[model samples]
Target chain A: MRFSEGTHRLHWATAPLRAFVFLIVYFVLLGFPLLLTQTDDGVRLELSAEVAVRFLLVTVPMTAIAVGSGLWAWLALRFRIDGDDLVVETGLLRKRRRSIPISRVQAIDLVRPLVTRVFALAEVRVELAGGEQSEIALRYLGRRSAQQLRAELLARAAGLPGHTPEAPERHLWRVPFGALLGSLVLRLPVLGAALLFFASLVFLVMYAEGGMLAVAVPVLLGLIRAVIAPMVMYANFTVATSPDGIRLRYGLLETRMQTLPPGRVQAVSIVEPMIWKAIGWARVEVTVAGYAGERQALSSTLLPVAPRHVALHLVSQVFPGTHIDAVPLLPASSKAVSVDRADGAGTDDVVFVSRHGWPCRRTDVIAHARAQSVRLTANPLQRLLGLATVHVDAPPGPVQVAASDRDLGEARAIVESTARRAQAARRAGGDPTHWAAR
Target chain B: MAAPPVYRADQAFAPGNGLRWSPNSKRHTWHRLLAAALWAVPVGAVGEFIVWRNGGGPVAAAMWIVAVVLGVVLAGTVAELDRRSLGYAERAEDLIVMHGVFVKRLIVVPYGRMQFVDVTAGLLERWMGIATVRMHTAAAATDATIPGLPAAEAAHLRDRLAQKGEERSMGL
Candidate 1:
């Protein structure tokens, strides 16, 4: 449990197996040319044996050297936490060393691939504030040790006590199995596959061609894969807010533990898919500056599935002044500008809100000060209908939030005023040095 | 509250062109000319060799000569136009960069939003005594790169941008 102690090596048993796997993959790739020569011509087939002998003559000694180096690397690779820094040293000949300040650590993730999972081992990836190249990884630790180190590293990075008295782990929400699986299978992919399968069946009946099997089988396989992957990845999805920060633990096969500190999240969005909307469900996602370097598909997800109200509450946790509830914001009319309405929708300065949807209702809001830029668009159909979409952009993040189908005049006014408000807010709060005093 | 500023797409924010300066005209022209020759020489040689080997007759050989001439002319013209269109302005809190020939693009990067500023020079640029200044923000789309500035000017811009970025990026 003492992470700050002297030095530690990875699980020793996995080293030899990892080295063997690496060699196997290397040989398979190298032997491909020989295989191709044997298939192409008989004269070349004789030369293939000579090539194989020459290859072994060179690679056998090379493999021996590599194995020797691998053993040395296993013995030499060591890590320690000294003061506020995590120091890792490896390589016998080149002798590489890396020291990462805990303060600069943005995220600590635990990944267990299929092979590693069988052995009950995990790999810890530490991402620093510096872009992608700044990542440091420690591979093949026992599952329990990996989890403990992830927590310790995250707490240290966020400048919080590793074990706080008041910091009890509070379970906020866990996605239900039915809802999670429903969200995955109810997407356009299944519908598309169904339509394609029907068309292929009709074509096969008409022409009696064997090509239909080629198309239908692959399409069916892809549909099955798409459904199963997310279902497995989000099987035990859960989110919570601890003193250290927002802690997320999910995945059935390859489990991951992620911590996102306050203020590190640049922007957040609450997305309710068409299918999920009918059931009053939503997903919350965020964008973090540190992890933006390498785009991980599902890294910034705050909540996989939650009720609309619960998702909104989580949004408020990250972005203090924002909410998704219906307030006395401006309401735009269909025909002419409506200043007469008690709650002026086509007016400026009250609140930025856009409401749309028929079977499902969608409302979007962005505080004036937090908006990076505001854009107004009116397609030909919308232009004819006198409606437009207002897109409020914040700093670059994983998720984007926009309000579609509003009165054109109101949309224009809202975007212009929002931009002005953003400029004024930046000017006023130009100095936050005193406020952020640690 | 007063009325907010309304933006019109056609009317861009006009920067102070009088205060802006272009790269050294003579040196830039030579740089583009040399680059065009570098591209033209290899293609011309290959084309001439292919035509000779194929016995494509004198007309085909003449066509290769014309193609090489056209390629050199097109590269040189585009480079000249690109050099003319590129410009940069330094405001109190932001840097504005504008460039493009057919479709104009204007980028405004606030000093507070700047994550880092870098100055780099490739081999040709170094030989020409020029460098490129790149300003990076947390948003990948907001990056602004200005090439063909004197090495000294590029360095000065880098230092000033770093200073302002540090001073302004105090909060978030």
Candidate 2:
């Protein structure tokens, strides 16, 4: 079927709402001048209501003009799906056109602000595969249409034929309230942050005794809020598998739905924080290209908090046919212990899985074909314990999944074997005809 | 046809012929120099204004000038040395980018995993006729880039990389 050539405008209700937002922003900016004025002596002083009234006469018209232009720009904007690409054209004076191929669409996120939610509308944001600031956002779409558009983009990107059987979506897991609260309380970072906050508060109270309660009360509330925010986000977190990819739905006050497609996931990491160690709870996260921009440091959490078995199960889905804890890692009593670390790193085709944690444990696994790079590192304490760490570098993410504290020689061996296996896998998979073709 | 040769799981594998390292264009030196000058302008202007207003004498002025000159020279030398250290090698299945002088870094991006290749140039780079080619892969650690290539070469490389990426991505 041929796609329509004509441009499609946004929902009609968007223009007035957009204009209202513009007016709010303009008035807020204009208020700066309204509240303060420069005196002849060059000192800025607060203005009275009489002066504010005088300023509003000029400010009101300026705001009206700004809103009028913003409405015009919004009206001029139009988008259409042409062939396999989503095309957007905007700007009344200097026209800007963008066409994003459906295949390049990496992720589509649906966000509903309080205002939009009241109107049963949502903002659809589409992220493309490469480039900084590669996002096409359509604000204020009817909730149902927004969801349909998201599904369509995802379906197209996956190259699924129309009328494919609807795979019954299954809920894989949900974050239990008990576990969510435990995760929040047991998080080492939050504890450390709280400690620092109290430490500074005590120091300030002792150093500056004036109005201590005034400062302490707000800061204390802020710290509590900071900790509670993430807890609330994970309160009812749910993971579901669909035809497109994985569906993540969570958040208490605001609901956000993110669809992550297959193969877009760069790396999967399961982190067991120190406090959560005894309970065997871990958080699973994945880094996807373009999601974190060029820095590539931020990771989107797949499971906010889950049991070790559940977390690993979720991770295995990303790396099909790979088991986390089933493989045999080099034991401390291996014969390779006596050999030089470098020499022990002899080739072996088997998958080297490293499981580590004292208070918390994490088992990271990658198929030889999927392994990126392997390195061995030994800290002072680990060296004293005759142990070394094998860090398997995946794509960009905050979590560095590593085999921590193995016998030095065994760690080296694991690194070497992993590298060799990865190379062999690459050759076998990459070159279909092999050397004969060449 | 004979079977494809198979390596023992233990055998060491080296990706490329240990040769043919291509360095970026020398024009990057001028581009870096211009950037350094532009950066120094604001600092120098602000310092001069503050010193003059505070009734500073000739020694302060001279010292500021020396510092500015030293900064520019240091930046230029580092830029040139860094440019020299940057090199890239493209194999059938992967691209390797080697860089850094004191602490070397070698990044290998598999073609099959490459998402896209971006060719970009800033105003200074455009004026100098050089562009930067960035290769995006599934893993952030393996993302490789070649800066200061001639614009034509950069564009050509971009197309070639994209084609190779597509051909190999099929295995994925």
Candidate 3:
């Protein structure tokens, strides 16, 4: 379908779905009192005078207003692709017209929440490179249209002409469900919560008390967030690569497909938690420019959990042709023993890598061309120890590249060398615009 | 004592690299003092009021006097140190900003990575004829600020930096 031809409205399903979502709590609350009226004769449809009045005066009108407004908003909402921008017009009384430049498009994500998924609809979120208010979402598009639109937007952003077929993705890896579950359970918080949960359960059984129930509830909630939520989110997590960039597909209840175009990733970090270290498991995260908002949590995650070698291999793939092992690592100076015992930093022709953190060892890798700035900092204690920290700045995200508590001289050297490397890399860097075209 | 180790002169970020660092305007000192006073006066007044209302007699007044004197002395010293510490240098490919006393920092932001340059002056700063020049890169953590330049200088620096940024524009 030609997106630039004319304006288009959202799917008709949007009206009812939006109304249902808005009144879900109201529906539940109304159903609850009805359920309480159940008896041996079965739930009677007898409504009390007060509830019946409320149903007529409040619930009926509220539902009508919700459905009416949803339908109105749907009617008012119209989006079309202009010459080089996606123009969205919405609202009736207070109209809003937003035109997002295709050139500044960072990443386009397709999200399918459970409700939307049930209706075979999806939400298309377009991320632009700027501050907080940089995301634009077009909700309740048909799943197929959402996918096609995402591909089209990506192709345009990559400076491809016409409706180019998406570059064929080569499957790289998929996180096994068992491994994901195991990894989540092995986490410190999850393990602690599990222990507390069992202890509380034992206490509740040993002595029938309400106090232990409170502890049990919170512990169970923590366990759910730490384990079950991630299990559902990262279920069937898959990674792939193509000429356009890297693609990630994951989620069970709410599916998400994120595409990171070439050269967009500012930095990558490999993390190995203490328990995961024993099992030789690791997680990889990256810092992408323009992902500084709510979507940052999942978008930054390159790999949720994988074997050590797989994580390293993925890192190498993220920044092609660079090998982590090939770069000679320099151990932190002995003078920094007080601050960091087992930490080191290294650099190669293409990337600067720093390994730090005690229980959870994190190795941050920033491509020379991607480095925005380099910093050398020293506190009084560090000054006394003749130690300083060299920090490589990228856009705001999870990946922090810092070589902390190094000898002052080494820190200074790192800063100078990194800056020079960044300058040289910038000179040779590929055109940021029209990435695929180049 | 033995002579200090002679590091390479080409180290751009080295503290003693002989770069011609431009200090903030002299009026910045007064501006900082006034700003500090603006904060301290109200805070100190509230604190003194709380102490007096609690029914402590002359002791509260004496304590406040000591506190005020100590605060002024500390603020004055800090203001001087801060004035001495803040410096920025425009180099061949990047701008370097150095500041802080107890915790010294030197940040080098490449011109090519700068998204924009912002020049701002608060009411107090405008009154004092001083402004701040902030160089923003795509990276939010790039803390490149020249906080106390004369108004004209700040504008000049902002324009020059903006021009350089455009010339060396490397999109993120």
Candidate 4:
């Protein structure tokens, strides 16, 4: 279907612009009448005219500044893609124009708020590999339009293809939800933020706004986000598989839909927060060519929620040679050493509590890192307890699936030993291609 | 017919040619720093002139002028270092960059990965006989640039890289 061809227009996305115009109108019409009113004094107030004129003078420039600023911003973000180049024509006064050839286009990512998503629209980001030049977005397109744009743009970069689609040759693994939420919330600075907001409100009430108003403002905003947190979260995240790429959709206000092909992914990590340990949840992230450490946005996440056991199967599908599901799990009778050292809790025996802690649930889980590079991390207390978290980094990037609190030298050794076996098996013609071979 | 393997200056020709010889690369370090310093001077002059004329005394004027000069000199020096430090690698498929200090990095981004690459020669860069090489990925997340590439080499590299990507992707 033919649709409007472009990013979110400046006039359309700048919501506050109309209000600014209204403010100018309001100041002139209403404030003018108020400022220039004849005083009750018998003498007609001459300054009334002056006051009205001054206000008018101030309003005109303020109005101009508001509208001008938005316009300038729009000018700074003028983007259009031509057959030859993905052109970024941005400037305030100088007219800075940049053209990125389509051949160089590597990936296109989408981002925006759920409101945009609710409208079935999002921002389309254009990226080239190795960081030459790329465009952040061609926004306000409906999902279909955005996808079409992305596909066409990518096809342009891919060049008229006579060759087959060249996605990576492997299935994708998904993480568990319980694990995702646990890690997300645990990492969230909610407590500190709540405390700070509380203090700010108190200060505002006690020192500035006084009493009810100050208290009301902070509490009101806080309560709203608290309520919104789960609701936004519910509609927040979704990841999917597409060709040789992974598509991730996330965000509350700024909804982001990103795609990372296997070629782009540099590393992959799976994190299970304390919360997921109870029900068994996990979150998976990848590292890509352009995207580096910490910001997992560059990579794809397998699952926001899943069962601990099911994780292996999902992983096996996504990343070849990463099939924990195919690998055998050992029971307690097996001689894998306990690596966990929680407080008085020792690795010899793990205490699995059903509930109550921010990660909120508890269970002892240990997965050996796929052996590529050896990494050992220890917290101050873990060190005191003579324990350190160790993971064997795997290629692609390191995959640290599980960790123990204390030093699990023996456990690490055993897992490495098993990893060797897994590696051997992979090398010995375990054709994962059997499942999804092109 | 097998396509003549397309190449960017960074990726074309030399085995270790990619180790440093990027196509179309000249050097932008001096020009950018010069521009910044030139821009800063007028700003500092204005501020100092204002204070001096406003009766803050010659000391304030002198101080402002000194500050502006120092800032420009320091910034220019730093830019020079950055320009001198960069090296490029070119191969048939991709442009490899071994750039940066304190954080020595090797970036091997395939032509397929490049969203687009721009070979630019501004007035000052033109005067210096240099060009800027910039490339992007589809994601638009990380942008890589080789500033101050020799203009002649840059045009050739840009054309070659662009041509290569076009043959493969059908994009600009």
Candidate 5:
């Protein structure tokens, strides 16, 4: 496991974000005196030399700190694999050299941000066998280099290498652009939370101080930008899978990359988000050994928002020979176990007793829970539509199966049953066919 | 039937286990005992800081050590009880380790679930002639660790786990 590829460092793409942080501090420092000035009445203060010296004194250190920190960060990362040893050389004064054997490099992926896509660059991350992180990262490399590194690692592992991944055929599910927009429009909770925050701020200001009524419109405009930002960031989000693994890249400012080993995938989940209830979109993700390059860092997301039927089809295509459709879902039959009741009713893992059922959009914990991020989610519409979904998420390599039970109880039951069945099968010579639902 | 040394030497893998499971290092009596002892160090360190700040009087320092030790010992008893209650397993097709000082755990790591098994010895562990053996299961939470194991024995255990896991995966 060695890296003999052309070596290069991280690009200067993150400068804008660094500058933005600097500007914020600079203005805050500058704003302190202006706020003091407004309290001084109509007289303008003269530009005194003492103030000039104070400003310079602060500015020099502030600039150096900003520049120095960014430089160190940019310099710390040098991702390479020489022969069999994968290298991660980082740090400023005291250098840290961490290396893993090539065989230890389990999974790898290429991440392209929405912006990086335009420039045609990808950040390649190599995941090691142990630890909770990807371990090494090479930021903003040409697509070819990412491909070549992936190939070399796979080949060294005695697995197939040099197989260029053709991007999955897009629009297989064919989710309409208008449908996406409508779902965005229907996401009232987000809009409501934003409006409520703004209104409260205004009410607080008007009733209390009442002075900043002058900058109201500009503040309102800024508020709108904040509201629409997340939707746009994830709007064009999509995933394209290759035979080797799953590759996902999305986001506006912050780009991300995730790669899963086909063998390490313990389980996968096909998620149907609540907002897309009417349109029926589902996303797929595989649970791997180490998780990183994710928006939800603590947890894993296969594809945050994708069409449902397409997701199922994609899963069958990827894993192969597994039941993909509804195969006698036992959960809907009220056979799943319940853990507790909201109001402390039955001692047995009480089935959620709410006849009106649960809030459609919710998350659930798993049998072998990894992070506290274990959740079962559905949208508001999915709630009203009388379909609740539960997924048992194991942190890294839990079974990647989704059983859409009628209620929370059913989901829990199915998961327990599946786990028991899996354990039984493993004991019985680990026959894959043992898992194929009769 | 008495289970064979859950691990063995000279043999690549063994057959005949009905089930396997992997659980993270589950809390044991030893772990509970260790956690209790850890609390005393912090207490002693802070008390040392206080003694240093004041006049370095042997009597005062000795008195502080007794008080801190007593308090930690009392607290540790309760904490150990709590720690013992929580346990987890990395269940697999072949092997399982039941762990818990508190909420008892049975983590089963079957042969197939053991992805990679390694025996590692750090400076101290090496000097002590002990090593840490890790078994990675397919499931994230399903892993097993047998720590403070003699180094020679740890190597034997790692080889056995890997061989058994691989053999089972290959349907041996």
Candidate 6:
């Protein structure tokens, strides 16, 4: 369990589970078409001895290769803690050695895909503060070992002394299944899809048109993917706070536990879809530095659905002393009322908040110190209107903090003030490297 | 609606804030023109070829010539204006880059937020003795690029920005 002492190998189940995952993909890709083939009489293809031999000939070698490579990869991969760095050695012939400094570790996530979960295995992903390639993934570790390794890495990253156990998590909130399903139903896309389905059904009944099948089938598929998929993924959503950071655990088929360390959240946005307003519900999303490109989707969601007030409480907890309601929100310039709503931007000692978007409203909050840059932009039309937009830039993620269509002078003031506040905050900011030492 | 807030030339953070905006080298205009020509020539030839293949009379040929001329003039005018608009200023805590004629944009990136500074020169730029200095921060949205600086100035600016970035380095 002491990860600092010796090199660690993945769980023995890794190879078999990895091979099983590959075989599933191969079957779906290669076998589906063959199974779906029909004769002139529309009877599905039967597995004759020749077909059986062919299938065996193909799959037998594929099984061997998959299992062989999986075992080989498992044999080649070795990781260990060396002083201040976590070194991972991989590759067989053209060897690769990646040594990541503990101080630079942004996050450590434990992911259990469905197949791996069946074997009580999880993948440990270490995200560093850099580009997309900065992540190191150790696939298929024993579930308990994965958790222990995560705790150890996080403790080391937080500058804790040797052998500190994982911090006790204080359960903050859990989304009820009824609320999760209700929230999904209330979504704009789902509601629209439902309406479309009903409309098409009526059309089909009244007109008896075969053409409607084309449209209905795709809509049903989209409904399954967009609505049902998230419903399953966000089931049993729970959030807990600890010294390691905010811990999020959720998923139905494939569970994941993600830790967002202190000072790592670059920006936060509380989103309230129009329909959800009736139920007083909102979703919280955040932007972290390293969760970019493909990983941005599921990882950025802090809370899938929560009551409006609970969401506010979670945001406050994430930012410690900052309270959304306490900040005096200034109205957008009178000139901007026609284009943008009166709700604009506000800033206090710690964070800057900007309210924008419509129907699906978003309130973006960013710590003054976390702002990477400040931008002021105006198109020819905006210039004529004497209005500009101020963008408080953060890392690439869903959270975008911008006050659009503000009076030019006010926009200029925002840019100057935000930059000044950011500079001062950085000067006063605590040392992030030694988070626990502080 | 309210007669638009009085537009001021010297707003605090405006591109025209009376800060000494260091413009790109004038040679950049010629470089841009050459780059434009590299594309225009082939496109013009294709257009002429199509006209000839279609057996269009001298009138069509004349119109094509006029169109090509207008395009070149437009490109030249844009290049000159863009060159004029491209400028940067070194503020106390941040570096400001401003460009664009139609949609003027000014971005202020604090030195502490800069992850790295890159100086790059394309073949055309190298031939024209110019390079570009780009500053990257943790945020990919930070678009801080000052192009068409004299090669030496670009190198000097890169070194200076890198040093400032180091001195103010705060990890994300």
Q: TM per model?
A: 0.71, 0.66, 0.91, 0.44, 0.53, 0.93
lDDT, candidate 4, A1-438, per-residue tens: 211235334324433443455566777776555455456774343565667677677777767766766565654666555655666666666887777776444356776654554556667776553432334556455566566656555544444331233343233443344544444454335455556667867777677856646555766577556545643543446656666356666655666666654333433444555545665665544434433232333334545555666554444434544443333333221222334322211111111111112343222222221122222343445434444443333222223323344233433343333333333433343322112232
TM-score of 1: 0.71
Off by over 4 Å in 2: A1-6, A27-63, A161-167, A192-222, A293-299, A331-395, A401-438, B1-107, B111-140, B143-172
Error of 2 at A66 (Å): 5.6
How many clashes in each structure? 2, 3, 0, 86, 61, 0
**What is the DockQ (computed on Cα atoms) for candidate 2?**
0.12
Mind giving the per-residue lDDT tens digits that candidate 5 earns over A164-221?
3333433333334455455454554656655665776777676874544545555566
| For model 6 chain B, the run of ten residues with the poorest summed lDDT | B1-10
Model no. 4, DockQ: 0.02
lDDT by residue (tens digit), candidate 3, A134-202 = 988889899888877887787887888648877899999999888998999997867878998999999
Worst 10 residues of 1 chain A by lDDT: A339-348
Clashing residue pairs, backbone N/CA/C < 3 A, model 6: none
Could you tell which candidate, 4 or 6, scores higher by TM-score? 6
lDDT of 2 by residue, A1-438 (tens): 212346666666676677777777766787565767768987575678877787788778876886687678668788877767888898888888989887776667787766777678888888764556777888867787677667656655655532233345778998888879877877666676677667767877788765566666766777677568777565588898765777888877667777777655655667777777777888886665546553243227788888889887887776555666655454342322332222111222434455545445454445556556554445455545556655556555555556555564455455545555666676664532111122
**Could you tell me the TM-score of chain A in candidate 5?**
0.57
Rank ordering of all candidates by DockQ, starting from the highest: 6, 3, 1, 2, 5, 4
**Candidate 3: which stretches are off by over 4 Å?**
A23-45, A48-60, A203-214, A338-342, B1-18, B38-63
Q: Rank the candidates by lDDT, best first.
A: 6, 3, 2, 1, 4, 5
Worst 10 residues of 6 chain A by lDDT: A333-342
Report the candidate with higher TM-score, 3 versus 6: 6
Q: lDDT at B39 for candidate 5?
A: 66
Clashing pairs in 1: A330-A345, A331-A345
Indicate whether candidate 2 or candidate 3 has the larger lDDT. 3
Which residue pairs collide in model 2, if any? Answer: A277-A359, A395-B140, A396-B140
Report the Cα RMSD per candidate. 8.1, 9.1, 4.0, 14.7, 12.0, 3.8
For every prediction, compared with the true complex, DockQ reads 0.13, 0.12, 0.47, 0.02, 0.08, 0.48
